[model samples]
Target chain A: MTYTAWILLTASLVGLSCGIIGVFLILRRMAMMADAISHTVLLGIVTAYLITRELSGVHMLVGAIIAGLLTAVLVQWFHSRGVQQDASIGVVFTTLFAIGVILIATQVGNVHLDVQHALMGEITFLPWNTIHLPVIGDIPKATLMLIVVFLVVLAFIIAFYKEWKITTFDAGLAASLGIPVVLMHYVFMTLVSITTVASFDAVGAIMVVAMLITPAAAAYLWTDRLSVMLVLSGAFGVISAIGGYYLAVWIDTSISGSMAFSTGILFLVSFIFSPNHGLMSRVVKPYTTTE
Target chain B: MSVLAVRDLSASYHKNKVLYDVDFEINQGSLTGIVGPNGAGKSTLLKVMLDLHPKLSGSVVFFGKNLSQTKTRIGYVPQRGSVDWDFPTNALDVVLMGLYGKIGWFKWPSKKDKALAMASLEKMGMADYANRQISQLSGGQQQRVFLARALVQDADLYFMDEPLVGVDAATESAIMETLKQLKENGKTVMVVHHDLLTVEEYFDHVMLLNKTIVKHGRTDETFTKENVQATYGGALRWMKEA
Candidate 1:
């Protein structure tokens, strides 16, 4: 496969995984929490690097997941202590992300990690960091990690489909039915953390937030069924990845930024033109009415 | 047989006590109405019994066992407005959630589960709205859909939080009819109700509450004007004149 193909594949896989989890976040009205987790994960990455004296992908992922879970726990604790939901998220993520930024700025100088790569990402250079495998010979390490994360997320959703559905829709009901709703919630947050950490190097925090929310939001506008919405969001994510790759190549811009931009565009299209709930359909309904 | 027993139950939210040493026993195969004023902790009582709220001091037992041990025999219908109606789901899908516990982990809803959901929808007069998105349904229809979900549970004990609020007259009658059928099937139901006029008509038993149980017995014996005045306090004068 060409280098560009590998990059596009990595982008698509990231989108697919992020998109699936994004639907649940949107449904639970925690899309901003995704943004919060992605930002706070930088703290985890830097802390791991500081401790291990290495910048391996596995170490960074572990660090980021821990940081993400901490963010969720702190937010919940604040909310329980009478702080508002958005306020708790805002306070936690900003403080942690600020610490992460300061650490990278002052301590990680001369290392391969830098502020620019942390913020904007370096998807173009992903193919250069290849890992040799038994059968595939060599593949980008990001692609392999993303594939594993994607499979894990897929298995989780399938295994706990009903639990997630009931919990997202009505947590009180889920609890009354003995579904262990709180445990399911933590498990879900852990998956979201994993997805955010895996997408760190490829899409960066900004695009991770974008992919984790926009496509799912777009799918929401198109369908009133959770199953269909999940499928549509996955499709929208892959389409945006492919479309964004070409658009980036054409315009000579950041691939992740272009992909995130495409997701926003797709969401706008759905907002305007969705069959049942779109603005256009509502506006045209009165004129089309014959009764 | 007692389906539920609550002893010395007390609960608070943010340091403000809501329920104070509440005690009640609900017998099997009876429809009981929990009635009280706006801040009288009627809903809090149900929540406390279900262990959904933090109890300052209490013990709730279900059929001689703890809640966790007897959860499969219990069903819940939350308030109509508590859920997001715009959630991306049809009525049938919401109804199918009743079987999630019975279906257990790592499994999908079987055909039998879907059929039971459909039958429950039909029982609540919501069969026509099975595929309709929940947000598009009328307020009364939405309430019926929730009722159907509870029906599909086939539980021995059901706790419904204001199932009749904001619903149409037909829907109210439909819900009452279903509750009657549940009673006929030897199932126990406790409803948090607001309409004082329908207490005698709807429930065989009534528990008037005001931070505690003021009266609890057969509706004919306990749902008197004095008990209501004690339950509602200043609010009962207007009710009396009406």
Candidate 2:
């Protein structure tokens, strides 16, 4: 595979995994929480590095999961205690992310970790980082991780389709019918955390939020069926991946940053041109163009 | 024998007490209406019994078993406003959620499940709108679809929270009709109702509540004006005028 092919595949997988799980985040109205979780996981990564003295995928993921869940629990606790929702999210993420920054500045002495890498991922290095496997030979580590993460995401959706849907749509009904609403909530959050860490290297921290929320939000405008919406979310993410890659190369810009920009652009286009719920429909609704 | 029983049920949110020592029993086939003013724990009672909220102290038994044990025998119709209408599912699909328990975990709904859901929608006069997205339905139509979903549960007992708050008269009559049919078929149904004027007319058994049960029994005897005033107290001038 050429250098461009590997980078595009990795970027596409990052977009696919984040975009698919992200439909739930958008539907559950937890998009803001997704952003918070993405940022706060940096704290988990830094703390794990401090303890382990080396950054490994498995260890970093475990740390990210623990930190992500902690942030979720803390945000929920504060909101339940009569604190406003946005305020709780803001306080928890900012405090935890600040701690992560402090740890990185103090402890990560001469280490390769830096805020710039975490924020705007250097995707040019993606092709060079290869892992040799038994049958597939040498594959980029990001590609391998993302492929596994994407499959798990697909399995989760396939296996728990009804449970996740009913819970997101109506919690009381889900609980009454013997579904463990709280447990299901945490389970889906764990999936999001996994997707976040898997996609983090390709999209970085800030852009990961864009990958998770933007494509799904854009797809949400086009379809009234969740199954179709899921497919569209992944497709749009791939489109952004493909489009942003060319844009980045053409302009000599950051690939992840360009991809995030593409997602925003797609969202804007969807917001205006969506057949059913778009601004065009709103304006032309009274005219009722019967075609 | 009573189909449902509650004893010493209390639930609190933070430092505030929502329900305290609320106890009640409903006989089999009783169409009991759980009524109270705002914040009287009407919804909280159902939520606690269903384990949606953490209970401070309570005992809820359905058919001589705990909630998890009798879950298949239980169904719930949450408030129409409880769910987002723009949930990207058709009316039939929403109704299909009713049978999620029976379909078992990790298994897709078969043709039989879809037929059951369609049948349930037909009962609510919603068969024609089955394929339509839920967001396109009218307020009353949406309530009817919700009732259809609960019907698909086919449970021995059902609990509903404020199913008639903003629905039109047609939906009100449709829901009341279904509730009556459920009772006639020997199913115990409990509704969290808000309208005080329709208590006696709509329910055979009534539980007038204000953080606790002011009265619980046959509506003719328990739903008297005095009991209602005592339950609502001066907090409701609307009831006084009525």
Candidate 3:
């Protein structure tokens, strides 16, 4: 496969996984919280690497999950203590992310990760880091990780469609009917952690936020059905990846940055042009039939 | 004969005591109205019994067993404003959520489930609006959808929070008719109601509560003006006559 194909594949998977979970995050008004989880997992990764002095996948995964959940808990704790919820989210992520930056700057000497790499991501060079597995032969390491997370997300959506739907829609009814509301919440946070860390290597910390929320928000304006929203958001993710790849090549710049930019463009277009819920539609309401 | 029983049930929100040592019970085939002032613990009491809120120290028995043991025979219509109406789903889909407990969790809804949901929507006179986005529905329509969702549960006991608030007269009558039908069918329903004028007419049993159970019994016997003044303190003026 061509390097371009591999890059698009990696970026697209990031788009797909982040887009789906991001839908729930957007609907639940947890988009900011999801961003906070993504950034704090950086601290978890840095803490793991600082202690072990080795870039082990398991350590990073464990550290990221812990950090993600910790971020959620601390935010909830502060909110309960009378702090505004968004302010708590901002305070928690910024503090942890700063500590991670300080640790990486002062202590880490041999590690390949830097603050820039953690934030902006380096998707342009992901194609060459290929690993030879027995069954799959040679596949890019980032691509393989992306595939695993994507499948995990897909399987979760498939298996718990009703559970996820009910819980997100109304926790009280879900709880009354004997659904494990707390368990469902934590499990979803764990998925956000895994997806955030998984996309970390490809889209960086910041663009992953863009990838997660932008496509989902755009899709939300178009459809009034959750099922349709999911599918459309996935398609928007692909559009961002493929279009952003071409844009990145044309400008000779950051692929992740271009992809994130494309998401914003898509969202802007949708916000202005969405038939039922867009700005243009409201303006044209008197002239057009809304059926 | 008791459908639900609460003993020494106390619950608090943070440092504030929301419900203090409340105790009550209801028999089968009863439609009980829980009436209280604005800050009264009427909603919290229902929440704690359903285990949606944590009880400080209490025992709540449903159908001679705990809530978990008898969950399938329970239905809840939480407040109409409890969920985001812009949730990208239609009325039929929302109604189908009631059947999830019966659908047995993690299992896809078959055509039978779809038909059940459709029938529930029809019962609420919302069959024409079944496919409409919930966000576009009127306040009364939204309440009807929520009731339809609870109706599909077919539970023996139902707990509805403020079902009449902000609803039109038509929806209010529809909801009252359904509530009466539930009682006629031997289903027990407890509603957190705010209006006091309709107390005697709408309910057979009334539980007047503030932070505690001030009075509880048959409406004619328990819903006296003296009992309501004691429960609401000076916070409530004269209730408006319908």
Question: Model 2 — TM-score against the truth?
Answer: 0.97
Winning candidate number (DockQ):
1
Tens digit of per-residue lDDT, candidate 1, span A77-177: 99988899999999999999999999999988788887677777879999989999998889998888899899999999988888899999999899888
**Per-prediction DockQ, in order?**
0.85, 0.84, 0.78
Worst 10 residues of 1 chain A by lDDT: A282-291
For candidate 2, the TM-score of chain A alone versus the native chain A is 0.96
lDDT per residue, candidate 3, A1-291, as tens digits?
888789889988998998899898998789998889989998999998888877656778788999998998899899888899999999999999999899889888667889999998888778888888997688888888789888988999889999999999999999999989888888888889989888888889999999999999999999999989999999899899889989989998888899999999999999999988899988877677644
Q: Write candidate 2's Cα lDDT for B4-89 as tens digits.
A: 89999999888789999888888999999999889999998898988888899979998899888899999988888888999999
User: Which is the better candidate, 1 or 2, if ranked by DockQ?
Assistant: 1
Please list all clashing residue pairs in model 1, or write none if there are none.
Answer: none
Question: Which lDDT values do the candidates have, in the order given?
Answer: 0.91, 0.90, 0.90
**Ten-residue stretch with the least lDDT total in model 3 chain B:** B233-242
Q: Model 2, A96-166: lDDT tens per residue?
A: 99999889998897886788877777788988888899988999887888898899999998889999999
Cα error, residue A16 of model 1, in Å, equals 0.7
Residue-level lDDT tens digits of model 1 in B1-242: 99899999999877888888888889999999999989889888878888788899979999999999998899999998888999999999999998899999888998999999999999999899999999989999999999999999989999999999999999999999999999999999999999998898999999998888999999999988888988898556645466
